[model samples]
Target: MFEKVDPQYLLEGVDGFIQEEVSYNLFYLITGFEEALTIKSCDSKVLFAQSPRGNPWLWVNRDLPEEERENALKLLIEYLDETPLTGVSSEPRTAEMFANLYGARYHTSIKRRMDMEAYACPQVVKPEGVSGCLRSAQLGDVETVAQYLAGFSEDGYGIVVDPASQMEAAEIMVCKGGLYMWLVDDRPVSMAQIAHRSPRHGRINAVFTPRNERRKGYAGAVVSGLCSILLGEGLVPMLYADMVNPASNRAYQKIGFIQSGQISDIRFE
Candidate 1:
């Protein structure tokens, strides 16, 4: 049976599993939004969270028998909704299974497959740039960061988001010293951010270089530098890249990131 649980209680129950797979679930659990909804089986074999922003996520123990997975998913569906979810994301196998069942019941489609990768700070070839340096984004850089974040959302996920909303998010990152920018001759050329860090895993995301700066290797430089800093702190750096974007996937690989696994972002339309 599935029952809703408090976030703290849920986190304690899944601590062991999440620490091992921290790269995947840290962002969802650490968002600090108390309204985030979590549900799991009585035996704690299956866990799901509906983020405060309405994103559904699932983590089912792979060791469970196939029949158990199906039953768990059925209970999740009943607790969440009888109708289709607007969007869902999870590991590739779970995503495919959930999408199949969701599509079987409603008119929905698989939106995208996001590949998650990790880097062990393997040697990186720093891009040839004599005038630029990576620096933490400051309050003065809020406007630029917001604009870049908006562009990133549009180009990466094809989602049009308000500049104000993006600014609000960027402000938080900047205040936390998590956002960084690559500056050339005192002008920002590219941006990246460290996000959702656990004790051992730190995620690099929101890597964006404006269209005019494309093909300049600024993004690679910024991300490589970020990885170096994260490694100095003794954390494994990881990030998600859109599978459809060959350039990004190639860029990240060149900087020593390897494909760890694939995940999916399914949208109901």
Candidate 2:
């Protein structure tokens, strides 16, 4: 049987598991969201969380017998009876299973949105010949950061967002001191942000290089430099790469990030 549980309950006994399967960091981080809801099986072998701002996420203990796992998923679907969900994200197989069942019950269509790979870096291999230094993004850099943010959205998702639309986010990130820029001769060339920090890992995201700055090793250099900083703080650096973006994935691998696992994002229409 599955029942609603406190979000904090989702973290208990899962620290080591999350450390090993870094892909589930989404599950770890979502619990902190203000409107997050969590549910787990009676034995706590299967877990699910929903965030008001994003798709629901599920995590089933992989060591369970296949039959047991399937049964738990079925119970979870029943437990969620009329609760509305637009999509689900989880390990590929689990997300597929839940999406299939959820769609069948709601008579909705299921679509795979994105195939994402989680990577963790144990070391940093700074790109050679990249003549840039990594520095914190300042308030004065908000406009540049906004442009890069807009470019990242367009390149990563094919969504043409106006740079002005990203100004507030750029200002907030800069004020948070988590955004970093790679500067060459005092000109910003690339950018990345330490999006979140968990117990033992720091998540990196929003990595971007302007179109004119591509092929100059700025992206790799900035990420490598950020990874070094995270490592110095005793946290492993991790990020998710869209499988369709081979260039970005290659750049990350070149800097010593190893593929830890895959997660599927599935939408119900």
Between which residue pairs do clashes occur in model 2?
none
Which of the numbered candidates is closest to the native, going by highest TM-score?
A: 2
TM-score of each: 0.82, 0.94
Q: Candidate 2 lDDT (Cα, whole model)? A: 0.87
Q: Pick the candidate with the highest lDDT.
A: 2
| N/CA/C clash count, model 2 | 0
Residues 81-141 of candidate 2: C-alpha lDDT, one tens digit per residue:
8888889998898888888887877898875489999999988888899897999999999
Candidate 1, which ten residues in sequence have the lowest lDDT sum? 22-31
Deviating ranges (above 4 Å) for candidate 1: 11-23, 27-32, 82-84, 103-131, 159-172
How accurate locally, in lDDT, is each candidate? 0.75, 0.87
Model 1's TM-score against the true structure: 0.82
